[model samples]
Target: MRLKDKVIIVTGSTTGIGKAIAKAAISEGAKVLVHGLEEDLGLQAIQELGEENTVLHIEDISAAGCPEKLVELAIKTWGKIDAIVNNAAWVVNSDIGTTGKAFLGKVLEVNSIAPFLLIKSALPYLSVSKGVVLNIGSVNAWSGEPNLLAYSISKGALMTMTRNLGDVLPRTHSVRVNQINPGWVLTERERQHKKQDGLSENWYEEIPAMYAPSGRILWPSEIAAAAVYWLADESGPISGQVVDLEQHPLMGRNAPKDPSTIHGKP
Candidate 1:
């Protein structure tokens, strides 16, 4: 019951990591606003998380007035907002040639700008309640795969914003902000995405040692578990921090140098 009676808003909660976080928050005695664009999936989330502890919000994060509406819904439903998990994002692939200004703009709008707006709209209430904001980022923010150029740029911007606000908000507004960057999580959508990319259905079972030091990547629930600490008061005044939730160190780590261990490309 670390988050007892807290009211949280988790965008993209209809599926994947966002849904897992909503489920975890409710289990800890919190009421949550589960948001997603898919009406059917939002209904499913509402059903699974229970109507008593959760409310569903269906909208495109990039659309105008969406952030304010989300804040309005949360406040109107529970009369208060304790935390906001900015987990909604556009995860798409595009290299240099494919990533034009519009592509980059759209990615930034959904992944970074929308989160900023949500925080701004909820800041007044959050400051009054001494609430927290958790941003779900990605390990790819530290430069990224060639195909994820625009997404990486957007996440990098978000990481910067989180660090900037993490310091600014806590002191000026009395609200804390922090971010978690998860690496290679095994979500349902990820399984389907990989299969579409020509990987076998059981590709996760045979990950390369370099990619999965523990013979597996990570799970949505595991990331959700990490998110709770930031949302709870137990985190104290800690702010302006970005934690990497990967199996191993992402920087300056040399591979085994064994070509035999590397079988084929992903």
Candidate 2:
């Protein structure tokens, strides 16, 4: 019950890591608002987590006014927000030449701009609560992943925002801003990419060792654990830092997933 009596709004929680985070938060006694494009899935989350503990908000984060609406709903329902997790994202696997302006714009808008708006709207409530903002970033924020150029740039911008907001927000308001850079997650997207690349069914098995040196693709559960740790009160002294959850590329290549070789140590 680390988040006992807390209120949190997680964007795009119908599936994937977002859903996992919402589920975890609820399990720890935080009333959660589940948001995403899938109305059915969002409702399902409310049902799964129990209607009393979870609320569903079906919307597209990419839309213009959705972010503010989300914050408003959280306040109306819970009286305050203890945390806001900006986990919604749009991704494109294309080089700059292969990606058109429209695609790039969409990527940046959803990945960077939308999160900014969400934070801006939530800042007032967060300031009063002295809340935390947990941004879900990616390893691509640092990696030069050619195929995911726009996606990388957008995430990189988010990482910068986390740092920028951390400095400015605390001085004027009490809210703390930080980010988590999830490693190569074995999510639906990764599975699809494996199939697209004609990789073996065991592609994920090799991924942890091959790409991350951890010999394990990060599961949604693991990421949720990290998020919860950050959101909880113990992390009050921690802010303005991006926790890189992936293994160091060079060290990871040395002995993938050899628990001893992997660096999960804080």
Model 2: residue 106 alpha-carbon error in angstroms: 1.1
Candidate 1 C-alpha error for residue 175, in Å: 0.3
Residue 121 CA error for candidate 2 (Å)? 0.6
**Candidate 2 lDDT tens digits, 1-266:** 99999999999898888989998998998999889998888888788878898778888898979998998888889899989999999866888688888888899889999999999999888988899999999988986488889899899999999999988887788888899998778776668877888998777664433455556777988899999999999887677889888756523355534443324431
Candidate 2 clashes between residue pairs 3 or more apart in a chain or in different chains: 208-216, 213-252, 214-257, 215-257
lDDT of 1 by residue, 157-243 (tens): 999999999989988999999999999999989999899999998999988878876777899999999999999989999999999
Instruction: Tell me how far the alpha carbon of residue 83 in candidate 2 is from the true structure, in angstroms, after superposition.
Output: 0.9
Worst 10 residues of 1 by lDDT: 257-266
Report lDDT (Cα) of residue 103, candidate 2.
Answer: 86
